[model samples]
Target: MTIRFPVLIALILALSAVGLTYEIAAGRVLAPFFGTSLLTWTTVIATVLGGFSLGSALGGIVAERPRAVALRNVRSALVATAVLMAVSPTLLGLLHSWGVRGTDGMMLSVILVFFPASVCVTLPSPLLAKLAIEARPGREGSSLGFVLAAGSVGAIFGAILAGFVTLPLIGSTATFAACGVAVLLCLPFVRGGQTGTPGTTIAAAVFVVFAGLAGTPACQYESGLSCLHVDRQGPEVRLVSDGTMQAAESTAPGEASDDGTVGLALSYTEWFWARMDRDLGPDPSVLFVGGGGYTLPTKLLASRPLAEAVAVEIDPLVTKVVRAHMPRAAEMIARTGFDAAEGDGAGRRLGIFHADGRVYLNETEQRFDAAVMDAFSSGSVPAHLVTREAFARLREIVEGPVYVNLLDRPDGPLARGVHAILRELYPHVEVVHGARTSTGRTNVLFAASRLPLAPLDSLPDRYSPARISDARAFTDDRGWVGHR
Candidate 1:
C-alpha cells in the first residue's frame, strides 16, 4: 500500500511536467501568426487553465467508484492527452493559413490547441489521487500533499527543461512532441493500464482525422507592398513576410522574429536614409530602434566613413533574413563602423540589443548622438512605443537629436498621433512632411530634442526634394483630430 501511494505521486509529477512544457511551447508556436502579444499569451494560459479545471472536475466524478477502475481511467486519460499534444501544433498551423490573421485568428488557434490537450493532460492527477486513497484506505491528506509536492517539483523541472534545453536545442515543436511522448510512456506503467481496446482504437482514429484536417494546407495571397511567403517547414507552417518570419504551430521556433521591423513600408526605410544623410553629418554614430531590411544600415555604409552604427532589432529572423537575402546590407553590418545586436545589449558608440526600445531607453545608461524611432507604420502603431511616457524614456537615452518616422498623409491618423505625442513630450518638435509616392502613404519626420531645435535656416542644405516643405507645428491634443 505504501509503495502504491509513492508510485501514484511519481505519476502525477511526471504528468504535470509534461503539461507545463506543453503550455510554453504552445505559446511560441502561435506567436508567428498571431504575434507575441500579451493578449495571445493571456488566451493561451486561460484556455489551458480552464481545460485543467474541467478535466479535474470530470475525472473526480468518473473516479468515485473503484480503485482499479480509477487507475485504468488515469491511464486512458494520459494516452488521450498524448495523442492531443502530438497533433495540436499541426492543427494550429492549418487554422492560421485559412485566412486567419490578427487577434481573432490567434484567439481561435489558442482555444483549439489548449482546450482538448489540457483536459486530457489534467485528468491524471485526480484519478491518481483516487487510486492512491483507495489503496492506502486512509491518510488521504498527507498522501495527496506528498504527491502534489512531487508534481510541483516536476513542474519546476519541466519549466527549466522547456526554457534551457528543449526550446533552445530542438526547437518548440520537437520539444512539445517529446513532452507528449513522455506522457504516453507514463500510461503503460500505471496499475490496471490496458494495452488496446476497441474504444482506444476509435479514439485514436478520431484523433487522426482531426489531425489530418488541422494539418491540411491552405492557400494564402501575398501583398506586393510587403513580401509574404508561406511554407511547410517540418511541424510548422512558416509565414515569412517583409523579411519577418513567424511559425504557426503550438511550438515557436527559437529563431522567430519578435521585433517590429518587418512589414514596414519600404518608402519609410528609403526616406529615413535620405533624411539621415541630409540632417546628420557624415561618419556619425547612428542608433536605430528597429532593424528591417538593413536598408538604412547599408545606405549608411555607402555614404559615410561609418564611424559607428548600432541597430537594435528584437527579431532574430529579421536579422537572419537580411543577412541571407541582402548581402549588401550584411556587408555593411560587417564593416568596422557598424555593430548589429539584439535590442537588449548595452551600448556607447555602437551595440545591438534584442529588447523593447522603450524598455531599453528607460533602462540603458548609454546615450546616442542620432537616435531614430523607426518602429511604427500606418496600419498599427505600437501604442506604448508612441506614448508620452515612452518619449520621456527616449529623451533619457539620447545624447544629441531624435528623429522619428511618422506614417502620415495630408491628414492621416499616424500623423495626428505623432503630433499629439510630440507636443506632450518635447519642448521643441518639428514635422517635415515628405512627398507622396506610388506606395500607400507619405511619411513625415518628427525631429525633436531637449537641445535647441535646429532652425529651418540652419538645417542642412541637402534636404531631399522629399523634404522641401517647411516644418509644421502640431498643436492638437487629440490624435488624428483633423482627419475625423
Candidate 2:
C-alpha cells in the first residue's frame, strides 16, 4: 500500500509537468498564427490555468463517491485533454481559412481551443490529491509535498526540454503534438483499475477525430504568409516566417500593400539600411539587436564603413536564412577576418551571437559606438528592450548615440508609446521620418543620446528635413512636444 501511494504520487507529478509543458508548447504552436506577444502568451496561460481550475473542481465533485470513481474521472479528463490539445491547431487553421484573421480571431481561437482543453486536463489534480490522501491519511502532508515537489522538478525539466530539444528539433506544431502524446500515455496508468465508461470513450474518440482534423494541413493564403501573425487590434498583421517577424500589414484585403514589399518584401530592407545610414553615418560600429533577413547587414557592408558589427538574433533559422540569402554580408565578414571569436583587432571586427538580445547585451563587456534598435515592429518591442530599465543598461554598453526604428503610425498610439519611452530615457531625442509609401504609413527613426544634440538648424545638410523642423522633442513628463 505504501509503495503504491508513492508511485501514484510520482505519476501525479509527472502529469502536472506534462500539463505545464503542454501549455508552453501551445504558445509556440500558436506563434506562427498569432505571433508570440505578451497578450497571446497571457491568453494561453490563463486559459490553461482556468481550464485546470475548472477541471479540478468538477473532477473533485464527480469523484466524491469513491476512489474508483475519482480515478476514472481523472483518467477520462487526461484523455480528453490530450485529444483536445491535438485538435486545437487545426481549429485555429480553419478559423484562418474562413478569412477570420486578426487579434480578435486569435483571442477567440485560443479561448475555444486552449480553454476547454486545459480545463479538461486540469480535472485530475484535485482528484489525484484526494486519492493520495485517502490511501495514506496519516502521511497526507508528506505525500502532497512530494507530489508538488515532483511537479516543480518536472516543470523545470519541461522548460529546459522545450528550449533545447522540442522547439529546435520538431518546430512548434510537432512539439505540441509530442506533448499531447505524452499526456495520452499517462491515461492508461491513471485508469489502472477503472473499466471503460461508454460516455467517456465516446468523448475521447470525438476529441481524437478533432485532433486529427486540426493537424491536417490546409491551403494557407499567399498574403497570409506575409502577415504571419495577427495582433489583437485584428486590423494589423505582422509578417513573420520561421518565428522572426519581417514586417506588418493591414488585414483588410484591399487595405494591404499591393507592392511586393507588403508581405515579407525586401524593400523594407533597403528602407531600413537607408535609415541606418542616415543616423549612424557611413562608418559606424553597430550592434543590431534582431537579424531579420540580414538585409541591413548586407547593405551596411556595401554602403557604410562598418568598423565592427555585431548581429544578435535569437532564432537560428533566421540566421541561417541571412547566411543563405545575404551572401555578400557573410563574405564581407569573412574577408574582414571577422568571425564569432572574441578578441581585438581586424579578426574580431564582426561577430554574430545567436542569443536573446537582452541577454547578450546584459552579459557582454563589449560596447558599441552606434546601437541601432531596428528590431521594433508589429506593435511589439521586446518589453525588456523598450523599458527605461533596459535603456539604462544600453547606456552602459553604448558610447555613441542610439538609433531606434519606430514602426508606429506618425501620430498613432504606438508612436505615442515610443515617444513616451524615448522621453524617459534620453535628454536629447529626435524623430526622423523614413520613406513614406502608399502601401503603409512611413517608418520613423528616434535618435536618443544623453549628450545635448546640436540645434536643428545647426545640423549639416546631410541631416535633411532639419532635425529641428521635422523633430519633436519629448520630455519624460510631457511626452512628444513640438517646442522645447
lDDT of every predicted structure (CA atoms): 0.60, 0.60
- Our tally of clashes for model 1 stands at 12
Write candidate 2's Cα lDDT for 299-383 as tens digits: 4554554456887776655545444443444465455534353544444555677677778878988878777776632335555
Winning candidate number (TM-score): 2
Report clash pairs, candidate 2.
51-119, 55-123, 87-211, 90-214, 103-232, 103-234, 282-305
Query: Could you tell me the TM-score of candidate 1?
Result: 0.70
Candidate 1 residue runs with Cα over 4 Å from true position: 1-3, 133-138, 193-195, 198-265, 314-321, 337-350, 354-365, 375-390, 405-421, 428-446, 450-484
lDDT for model 2, on a 0 to 1 scale? 0.60
**Compared with the true structure, what per-residue lDDT tens digits does model 1 show for residues 349-382?**
3355656666766676766667788763113334
